[model samples]
Target: MVRRAKLVNDAVELVPVLQLFSTETYRRVYETLLSEWRTLEELKQLYGEGVEEALRILKNAGMLEIKWRMPSDPAGKPEKEYHVSYTHLSINVYISLKELNTILNAIFMAEDEESEIVDRILEQIGRGRISVQHISRETGLDNLFIRALAKKSLKLNLKGQLVEPAKNEEV
Candidate 1:
């Protein structure tokens, strides 16, 4: 039980982990882990016998992995513990004019219009992608300004360039 609680707590500590699973599953697993450690049977019953199925799905989707530990008992080892390993997904996002406008509106609601500040924050937090913060810092613009500029930039955007053009080729 303590082990299960620990595992759930670890997942909860990482917001992305919670986001990886469906809300209901996250809530139920959280609640269950918070309580006494449940046997596989108990877990199955709690999840309408779909616990295994759910794990299978999560595993297959590369979203989660489970590790089983042997129970400490005189009898032959039982599946003692189950731990969930969550995978972080990386997705490249290309924003259309409309989407860029939406994001700009959402981030610019602050009275200070810390658009530039926000962009800097995003850039600093980039995960193989440029964030608003990066754009803001690079261009010395506010979040709103950066956002607008980014929209314009995207309009003229070429697909991500994998290899830089050689000196002789057009830039």
Candidate 2:
């Protein structure tokens, strides 16, 4: 059976929920759950392995609601069903700089290829905010990967799929 709950309004707490919402997979998952309930298996079939992380993000962001349902057999284990916790979202844009700093950490050399990705993003967005798709085309890195790097770039600001130079600040 499917469930469609009334859209609930919840003001977001901070960057993670807002940031996760900007992701493609997260949006797709949220859309999928809007009109129907699905077991993990069902979601996995649609999204493959990416569903796990996406679901985790949704759950952590208070955007996914879950309930357990009994299986067909009397002795079988119950199955977990999932749906959207809220359909409406609002974000207050007045976060403190300290909190913003927490989300917009300076890009660091964490591993191989990170520098390359950061370099690419920096080079591409010099004039203005550029689409993640454009950076993906130039760097051959996936959009999601580039987004992850952009979030950490002190020199960059991420707004949805767009990445731009950090303003009124020295790097």
Candidate 3:
């Protein structure tokens, strides 16, 4: 079953698969799989055997393209390898520093809390739809209060503006 969950801000959404890749693992595999076409052995060497399954997950998510064939040579058969394919999504989920932190935090907090709001805030911020002034005025809260909340959860620094957290700190 494919489960589609709306992104908090509704700009981006997620398709739930049984095999969920962590943010870092997803980037590593995506880069490797796209940069140079590799057989499952090469992937297992760099990312571990678990990556074969991860690749299948991405394929099912429509994020990867797979090529499978059993070649019979005059002397012996050759193993199958995958080819690089264009990623369909335009929003670069891997490039943004702040959004990465927000996603990581959400993953950690998924058990006891509703961190979808964090993703919503990030999506709006990324789209330039939400601003610090707007957030403060809309919520009728002070800048410090908002920043504190952001810090506690997403670790973002919303002092001057609702900006991303420092790369050194983890939420």
Q: Who wins the lDDT comparison?
A: 2
Candidates, ranked, TM-score: 2, 3, 1
Every model's TM-score: 0.31, 0.48, 0.38
lDDT of 3: 0.49
Candidate 2 off by > 4 Å: 1-12, 96-171
Best by TM-score: 2
What ranking emerges by lDDT with the best candidate at the front? 2, 3, 1
TM-score of 3: 0.38
Model 1 residue 97 CA deviation in Å: 12
- Clashes counted in candidate 1 amount to 8
Instruction: List, residue by residue over 1-171, the lDDT tens digit for candidate 1.
Output: 333221322111222232325447544653564444445566766766545544433332334434455656768666633344432333445546765454445333453444444444344444333554554456565544443333222111211221111122110
* Better candidate by TM-score, 1 or 3: 3
Weakest lDDT window of 10 consecutive positions for candidate 1: 162-171
> Each model's RMSD to truth, in Å?
15.7, 13.5, 14.5
Q: Any runs in candidate 3 off by more than 4 Å, and if so which?
A: 1-13, 16-23, 68-73, 88-171
